[model samples]
Target: MTRSTLPIWRRIEFTVLLAALTVGGGIWGFVELLEVARDKTAHSFDTRILLAFRTPGDPSDPIGPGWVEEAMRDLTALGSTAILLFIVVTVLLYLLLDGKRRAALFILLAVAGGQVLSSFLKLGVERPRPDLVSHMAEVYTLSFPSGHAMLSAVTYLTLGSLMAHILQRRTLKIYVLSVAVIATLLVGISRVYLGVHWPTDVLAGWCAGTAWAMLCWLIAHGLQSSRARPLD
Candidate 1:
């Protein structure tokens, strides 16, 4: 009846309920952002937020020390396709070498699926990058949902959760997940600061990314539980 005495299935049920809520909320938020993206008047928030990062009368010069720009660029690279792919490759190789084929495969499918979904949504929305200000970062993709933000969430959060599942200590689990969340946040914020994406784009990316990552986690959890048949 108490927390310590609760069955494993019961704990899993709780997690399922939470993940369901997260997915539903994320979908709802993305829909709302999509509607806002279509409304011209509603884009004021994006303009104001983007311009705030620039100098008072100059869109070309961002308002900050030189190092700040460098830092933002570094943060942006953390979500770059090249960097994310490298991380994915390294993790997959490690898992495969350690004989965690199932986990490795799940990572591959989750990240690849996220890339596909990001592309589909970008084409579906066909939103343009913010032109109200000069872009500090070069981007060639459609911009409703920031791909960097989304993919970063998909990669870091999925890997973080997986690491948490592997580690034994509760503190370590929390630390790993916290770092993942922070990295995701920094990537999203960097997109906005660099004038490459509207704030709504980043928001939608975070929502969708979080939802996808959590759903994948739930699926992996179910698979793990099913495979670990315990004796009565």
Candidate 2:
């Protein structure tokens, strides 16, 4: 069918499929790179690069061990509460302002679904964390995909996208999105810097989380559009 004649749901499905393919391909490429890094010669090259940028557990800088420790403590302290608050506030805002309850539902589904997927992937992969340094926090789960990274991407990016739709100024919207993206990146990096996760773990988390978030957005948008359209 022609573009104009094609159904909206079908277009949305096509877009979602394309997004899945792109994310899957990127993840596969990253896995291949990790495999290459496992080789002795290739491993040495990777190790040198990592060492060049390594911050040797200094307690001085804001991004150093002391800061990371405090941040992790704060994150753990506010973890469940923050998630609950995020859900409650988003739902209330959507209901009161735009009556877009679907947006709030989408955010919950995306983040929760991503969490489940990340957990399953981590268990299946069963990758262990690096033992090169002392971990700042204790963790017993598999380390292939960082939960913090996945949740950060899902929560921050989803909220940022929703905010973008509501906000008027293009620059303000872009700034919000940029901050979300940067925060997601920094949180993921913090896990690695704290010696709690492998670099590959964070990368995989970001890819999977982003893909799931986009999928949820596509679904929510498609539903909203359908509701707006007149009956056949």
TM values, all candidates? 0.89, 0.69
Local accuracy of candidate 2 as per-residue lDDT tens digits, 1-232: 7877888766655655765675676567546645643443424443443343356463222244466567755553222337635754765576457665555565566666766776676675655666655676677777666777777777677666655655679999899879778877877766765566666667777776676666665555555567552111
In model 2, where do residues sit more than 4 Å from their true spots? Answer: 1-98, 166-168, 227-232
CA lDDT scores, all candidates in order: 0.85, 0.61
TM-score of 2: 0.69
Once model 2 is optimally superposed onto the true structure by TM-score, how far is the C-alpha of residue 167 displaced, in angstroms? 4.0
Query: Candidate 1, residues 5-73: lDDT per residue as tens digits?
Result: 888767657767888789889889989999988775548788888889999899888889999998999
Which pairs clash inside model 1?
A: none
